[model samples]
Target: MNPALPLARLGRATLDALAAIGQVTLFALSALSHLVRPPFYLREFGQQVMQVGWFSLPVVGMTALFTGGALALQIYAGGARFNAEAVVPQIVAIGMARELGPVMAGLMVAARVASSIAAELGTMKVTEQIDALTTLSTHPVKYLAVPRLLAATLAMPVLVAVADAIGIMGGWLVGTTRLGFNSAAYLKNTTDFLQAWDIGSGLVKGAVFGFIVALMGCWFGMNSARGAQGVGRATKGAVVAASVLILAANYVLTELFFSA
Candidate 1:
């Protein structure tokens, strides 16, 4: 193996990554611009809000509840080792409000909504429906991408707020029923420990993650290759990209919000 060959391959990969970023950034900007200049599709936007928000509630709630419970148990177990088991309520509230609730909700939405949007749009692309829209004088990005993107961005914060409440309640339930803590005291500790900024930061993270999810789906689908296998790949790529970006963005936002 030639040393120069590996360097060439690394350079190619770096260029490819940069090209992808540029393409995605342009796509997002186009969709955003369309949002303000529209024969506004109120019906499409409403449908997407339901699809991305209301239908996503059950999965987000379930994930938050179970995660909150497990977190409480783990915190209690670890804290017990230090004779600090009483910290369970406070820790769970902070963890769920500041981190787990938003991250888990974002991931769940990425898995469900991103994949669905990619598949739907990919199928439309493969079937020439997008071309039909163009011929009929409708901008596909405005009709399809804007609704989904705007809906997700607006809806995710609401979902995250619900997740945070359910998550805190889950901790309370576990602490009271399984961990031998007084319910009222657990609630008080949680409320006392969780700051308004923590929850607000998580909601902001949720909105960003939602935008990323829809952007990945729309970008991959619109650029999908022309075949069934291509659509499949686009769907997979959308979910993977959305999920990774959510995690990465989560860290960046956390650093900005909480760093000393």
Candidate 2:
């Protein structure tokens, strides 16, 4: 008897998804256009840079450190079976610099910053504060989205850089104390094996991931539906979308950088 209800719900869900996608596209174009124009919001950008990059340092650092420490232990353990334990330093450096460092940092920032941005903008939309900004002749895209995109894109590499350093330190601690690695010898092995390009490529990947995170957050928020339900939906959607995109982009970048 209620078969029609489920069909109607399916139709409504399809429409909502289409509407959200359209809104996200328009927001991206508007933000892109505004990015090139004047009336730059350095103040806003600085705040976002601090929020997305600086404020995220502790989480990012801790993530990297734990990952590096675990990686060192695992690598050493695995290598020991084959009498290949000497590969630990090289593997650690390569693994962190190539993949884990940027990807983990990106995910952390996406979780922390993306959801917050979506909630903030969704709140503004619901309260008509966005309209107020428009009434005051302020382009919300320029003032909000562009700054966030720039901040995340520019700051992610720096975060990854710090993460890389901290990660290496964690490996150093594990290698020297637990793994019976000579401190000086481990240091020399790591430094000698790592190339500058390995680190640089990871930072580049981080920047791209950062852009995706901010873009998804701003897109979802700017296009958020009305009411409390809409805000909650948008916030959750933004985080999920950003996380997926980060992992997807990481894979693409890895292929591009490493494939012959």
Best by TM-score: 1
| Displacement of the residue 34 alpha carbon in candidate 1, Å | 1.0
Candidates in order have lDDT scores of 0.94, 0.92
Q: Provide the TM-score for each candidate, comma-separated.
A: 0.98, 0.92
Off by over 4 Å in 2: 1-23
The 10 consecutive residues of candidate 2 with the worst lDDT sum are 20-29
Structure candidate 2, residue pairs in collision: none
Error of 1 at 24 (Å): 0.3
User: Which residue pairs clash in candidate 1?
Assistant: none
Model 1 residue 72 distance off true place after TM-score fit, in angstroms: 0.3
| Prediction-by-prediction clash tally | 0, 0
Report lDDT (Cα) of residue 114, candidate 1: 96
lDDT of 1 by residue, 1-260 (tens): 89799899999999999999999999999999999995999999999999999999999999999999999999999999989999999998889988999999999999999999999999999999999999999999999999999999999999999999999889888999999999889988888888899899999999999999999989888888999999999999999999999999999999999999
Displacement of the residue 3 alpha carbon in candidate 2, Å: 12
lDDT of 2 at 240: 98
TM-score: model 2 vs. ground truth: 0.92
